[model samples]
Target: MGTWIIDAIATRHDRSGFSCGQPSLDEFLQTRVSQYQRRNLGQTFVAVPQGEDANNHRVIGYYTLAASAVAFQNLPLVRSRRLPKHPVPVVLLARLAVDRAHQRKGLGEGLLLDALQRTQAIATELGIYAVEVDAIDDSVAAFYTRYGFAPLLDQPRHLFLPIETIDRAIDAAS
Candidate 1:
């Protein structure tokens, strides 16, 4: 496998060739990421081959992070009991996808780790309680569950991993 450098997406990064076998995700990278960024809705990060030149880098995987809130009632009782009754702030992992050619090569895990690491750093200065994700299906939900995410009480496919858990994971990885 080749080395990859994950960073904020730029106009210089080439994304037209990315295909993750998920049409909506593929189309988002190709079309909507910039708009979301411009509107302050989210920021998309991309993983490209490490040695590629500035203008020649091809995005092989990507993830988007956005500021979001979740209703206190949606959280599981165990996680929400100590918090206030209002909505809780969170980092929304809006999208995560690896190119079809790059699937099964551990790139998906890499992207997820990168997102969590970024979330941890941001949480140090922000009021983020957790990182949440809306899995497209049960299989994807399972993937997040394996990494310690807990599903929302009312929506199983909407999962979250607390900042505390992310801290533990990062410390262990280090």
Candidate 2:
């Protein structure tokens, strides 16, 4: 296992090698970065070697967190009824990708776990309701599901893990 130092990209200058390894992600960054700038909705957490030239950093994996909403109508029946009618403030785990070179190193899972931990902390501090993610594909959806995420409503690709769920998972793991 490789030692990774995880930290937020504090400035635009810190965004080196932040492009997604996946093509869809690349396009989103190219076309959407500017439009989404005002909201600062997109965030990147870079993982670097414990001790190396920071500029020579390779983004082994990254996941973006954003302020997002999911309509109550789009939530699962059990969750929907429990939520308010209007859109709720959600922390979106929008995209996550691991570099091809680091494919089997468990780095992807580490990034995800870090994302969840950070989001959960934010939710508690800011009173957000849920941590949501839009899975890029069925396989990605399955990965989140294995980690206790549930599909929102009938939308198989949109999933969420409530703060309680996250807490339970952490407790179980510990």
Candidate 3:
């Protein structure tokens, strides 16, 4: 509602103008997004630039979410001991990117908050225990940590935030 109208990626979202400064991410959107969605590998939500004519709504950013799991062994001892000996169900925040033109203007945070809200809502019906993200770098990891994500003891780049934390944050904001 700021400058974006977020929605599931559609054929008419004007996909040609996105470039997030990451070649892989840019290429993924340019070529792989549709195939991945068709194969059910992931679901991408794109943020289209609002205020433009209906026929020219440009995509400024996007994020992907998908069902995923974390092996019990990967969890911290304190956490792993409390759960049954099995993989924990989680929602994966697979990819998130903002176009270069939209970077440094809070679009990344907006995308992340949207992803967190969606994961929190979907978990109640889907039985997810947590929302997980694999950070692309140290800076990305730090960003998630600031948002209350805990790093995996075995894998620093992998982070998680429990559903309870999401609930608390929403409650606090409300």
What Cα-based lDDT does every candidate model obtain? Answer: 0.93, 0.74, 0.88
Q: What tens-digit string does per-residue lDDT give for candidate 3 at 11-60?
A: 87887878988888999998899999999999999998777788777889
Q: Which ten residues in a row have the lowest lDDT in candidate 2?
A: 9-18
Arranged by lDDT, best first:
1, 3, 2
Candidate 2, position 87, lDDT: 84
RMSDs, each prediction? 1.2, 2.9, 1.2
Q: List the residue pairs that clash in candidate 1.
A: none
On a 0 to 100 scale, what is the lDDT of residue 119 in model 1?
Answer: 98
lDDT of 2 by residue, 61-117 (tens): 667788888787887777767666988778998878766666668888898899988
Q: Which ten residues in a row have the lowest lDDT in candidate 1?
A: 1-10
**Shift in Å, residue 82, candidate 2:** 3.2
Among residues 3 or more apart in sequence or in different chains, the pairs in candidate 3 whose N, CA or C atoms overlap within 3 Å are none
* Pairs in steric clash, model 2: 75-153, 76-153
Candidate 3 or 2, higher lDDT: 3
Q: Cα deviation of 48 in candidate 3 (Å)? A: 1.4
Q: Which candidate wins on lDDT?
A: 1
Per-model clash counts, in order, read: 0, 2, 0
Winner on TM-score (1 vs 2): 1
